[model samples]
Target: MNISKEIVENVSGIDIVEYIIENDNGIAIGIINFGATITKIITPDRYGNLENMVVGFDNKSKYLKNFLHFGSVIGRVAGRVYKGKLTIDDVAYNLDLNLNDTHIHGGENGFHSRVWDTEEIYEEDKVGVKLRYISLDGEEGFPGTVETKVVYSLNNENELEFEVEATTDKTTVVNITNHSYFNLSGNFKENILNHYLKINADRFLPIYKNGDISGKINTVENTVFDFRKGKLIGEDIDKKLEQLTFADGYDHPLLFDDKIGKIELWESNSGRHMEITTNNEAVIFYSGNCFMKKTPFSKKDKNRRIALCLETQNLPIGENEVFKENSILRKNEVYKRTTKYKFSVI
Candidate 1:
């Protein structure tokens, strides 16, 4: 693997740089220091033509203008919190509610909005960039002075891997995930409804209009959320399901089993396929339901299902059992998680 770096923008005495890591197999991945985000990912199609596989802006100028998290790493808490309330260690912490009065993706000044310190790394077969961030104890109403490190590495096997590690001084909530919207058709000129997808899980968490997880774990046996056997993303997206109506489409969490993940996706037009494997127990599959023409998030049209997200994380945000158990990162406890996206051409 080869590594190169360039400064894309200078903001407030900070330089937002992009690092390009290329492997021998023609797979190249681009990451930016601002937000520790993935800016570009290039892979070859079946016809042997290379094209970018993720959506992102051209430079830091466009990045600063667009608030939508294209390929950035979401953190502190990746999903919504119930009513933005948390009573950890008998002290109530009121967080900034970005959407619908619920604390979503860390809060107003989340990890996605900061420029992290970066270190370039080199090895025999792989090169990577390590990004670090220090979140103050009460920056976003969280209790811990947290230190985080995320490494994005591209290797010869066409695998783009994300390894995250963090430690907090005082006990705090932490759930980190990459917010990369994928349209495996090589580009976003068209919607991703025709793409085929299959997830191994048979149960999913339902959601409310406010984006909070509602109700218990429901079976996807007879629902549109079912992707156990692999099916076109559009097959049941328009069905008259209650959850579908609430979110305008699919915005829920599907259980994950590493034994046979089934997190496989392929574009019929481009013959580009991707498989995701992760250590997180649940994943949020969010269809781009809020996209609009006025929304500067994309150059693509304001389509309902243009891009879909597969965010692997600990648990869905709401009042849940897992929330009581996994969300809190205690002091001296090192938190670690890994998610990998491997690419190929059918």
Candidate 2:
């Protein structure tokens, strides 16, 4: 495996660098540096048809002009912080409010909006590209200058392995992940209402305004949040629930039980099945309802549920003791998590 880097000029005058990784099956994935984003990931369909499974912009200007985080690595703090503020050691700090009344994705200037140092590592067995960046103290109203690295690897097993690591100077909160909107079926025309989904979570954290959990972990018996037994994704998306009106459908985090193993997803259209395995305690199943409705850059029509994000991460703002326990990483402690998504044909 010989990895190569090429400089391609986008319309926005930003010189974008593309890193190509080739797998044994002749499949390849292209990543860009403009936003530390996944430019393209080409895979085969049921009939050996190749298509791009991830949603993204066509060029660098679309990424700049549009608001789609696309397939970029998000960081500092991946999800929302209550009211654009967080308290550390009895001290409160204010962050930039990008999402209306709250701070989303590490405020207006997160790691996705920056350029990182990249290196392409090649090997006969596997190939990957590593993106590294450092955040200064108080950059997004968070403590410590954090050094972070994200490695994107594609192997012979058809698994996309995302390895994320970070270390902080002072004790600052960190939750990094790839904000890639996935339409695994490769058919964006219709909603993914027939897609069968299963999660190991018996409980979920209900999100509310002012950064508070609505209640304790609830059972998934008849509740709309139930996905434990593999149900159609859009089965109950339109129910008149209280949280649905506040954050839209399925915007909360799913709490995985300790006894559960790998999570599975089956796409009826493409016959593509995906399995996710991680060492973390929880996985956030974001339905992408806020894609273009709340923000700007999504290429989707407001009414169409075009994409879904299975973001495997530690709970949002791990500093919140009630929301996620044992999430705080102290000084001299290393924070590491690996999320692997394997593709298979049904």
Candidate 3:
């Protein structure tokens, strides 16, 4: 079915487009134009009652006014950049340091702040929405005029797949990921402490003294970073770590020991389960410890440790030599990444 295109007023004058996708199993996905955000994902439970599976503000103005990124597509880079500065092709660029003197999420006016042109593609067997945005030169202090496209598809097998592709005229770093907070139980759970979490990474990138990548992967054994054995998130969060002091949670990139196939993570609670898989080697597991409780943007209480974000992306800059290889997209070269989330009841 074709997505019905309609304009929804967000800000005073800013309008957002809503793309609706309906599946045979009564699952519906509502996507918005501002930042290409996934506003609502409605799926039926075992009792055939539908509920929103993701957490987000009801109004778009709240999204603009709130400090939380919230279900938006983050980019030109997702993680932190040291001192809000970077040298691309011998040219030094300074960006808006939004957090702790470091450039986070491509700076203050990154792709998440821009409106994108969208196209809804429908086939007999599959349905998807493609959103495209072009970032002009020097936009948010970035060098290149970058063209980015993200396609969100819902397959018959109950998979939410996101595909990201970008091209730039100038040399720049690009890391994009969807910031969706999932609660498999579909109950607006106060915390995910009981959710059995598993990460395939054996090591992680360590932060240096200056809040940048330390250029090394530390072992996960006997440390708070260890999720290799599938443990609860709260079991080791408050255990005192230097990196957590800044972000207040697990904002570090997990370095997977395996280089092939998919990196997988599973969460189970109350007979409901969720599984995430990605082609990327790293996944940033954030426990949302920085979010404010009972904020205006949060329809329900969104206090610290409420929702968790599993951002699959490259390591923060300078952390791994592998990023230099994995993220190097030369002129006319194409880079591709795919991440999928599937939900079920066990």
Candidate 4:
């Protein structure tokens, strides 16, 4: 295992450093301190051809306009908060309404837009980077001063792990997850429609047309949202179901079934397979429904369905009393979660 770092760019007088970690197997991942974002994940296909497996920008300037959230750390909260209203112990806090009167992914200046302090990790069996970010009290209209640490490690077993730990000085709600768009075909050779996915979820939360959670938990049985048996992503994506039409694709949250094991994704053409294991309760499977054709990506011809994201985290605390209560991080208590992605050839 090896880890290397180089100064990539300077943003507003702050130096942005990119760290590259690789294993003996030649699987590597590049991470930039800016947003602690993942720039590339180079892995081999069936025939030993390597290519980037994620959607990112080659030019540093394009990262500044990463509205897609690409491969960055999403913070404070992973999904939308109902109407931007949050309450903690009888104290009402109004968060920034950045997404059509809804507070989505922290806020306009969420963790995804900030530069984090990083430290390289060199271990006997693995190589990684530890990134830390301090969210000031009321920075994005939330409560408490939060100190978050995220460690990303790559091991010889072709496992990329994310371990997150956070603490707050006051009672506040916290949920963090990485928004990495994965295209197992490597260099965007084809859309993810043909990819077969199996999520260990039996229920899903429905969303409105505007992408807000409807606060109702429905079973996935006999519905288009069902992925229990593993099916091609595009098989029923274009169906005229209300949930499919709401977000134009799969952008809703699926509650994880503890009895089941892990989330699996397979790209047959490349023989690349990925298994996702997370301690979180839910995952948001986004089908890149909102990707605009006009926007330039690292590769050309990138449009909707070019990639997909499986964001593992707690259910969005959108006016859900149970979710809000469980997401609270009080003083002296540590919030920790782990998510792992293991890659291999079929």
Across 82-163, the per-residue lDDT of candidate 1 in tens digits comes to: 8888888988888888877788888767898898999998977788999999999898888989999999988888888899
Where does model 3 exceed 4 Å of error? Answer: 1-6, 10-14, 46-48, 208-211, 241-247, 260-269, 293-302, 318-326
**lDDT against true structure, model 1:** 0.83
lDDT of each: 0.83, 0.72, 0.72, 0.89
RMSD of each predicted structure: 1.8, 3.0, 2.9, 1.5
How does candidate 1 fare on TM-score?
Answer: 0.95
Locate the minimum summed-lDDT window of 10 residues in model 4: 293-302
Task: lDDT winner between 1 and 2, please give it.
Answer: 1
Error of 1 at 94 (Å): 0.4
TM of each candidate vs. truth = 0.95, 0.89, 0.89, 0.97
Stronger candidate by TM-score (1 vs 4)? 4
Worst 10 residues of 2 by lDDT: 318-327
Error of 4 at 154 (Å): 0.6
Off by over 4 Å in 4: 259-261, 298-301, 320-322
Ranking of all predicted structures according to TM-score, beginning with the best and ending with the worst: 4, 1, 2, 3
After superposing all C-alphas onto the true structure, candidate 3 shows an RMSD in angstroms of 2.9
Candidate 1 residues lying further than 4 Å off, grouped into runs, are 258-262, 294-302, 320-322
Per-residue error at 13 for model 1, in Å? 1.3
| Candidate 4 all-Cα RMSD | 1.5
1-346: candidate 3 lDDT, tens digit per residue: 3355567665666677777776677667778877888877776666665777677776656666434667788888887776767766666778788878777877777877778888888877768899999988888787777889999888677777889999988777778888777655564654766566888788887776555775777888877887877787778777677776766667778877676324333344345556777877788777777676545334445465666788888776663233544554556766678888775656
Summed over model 3, clashes come to 0
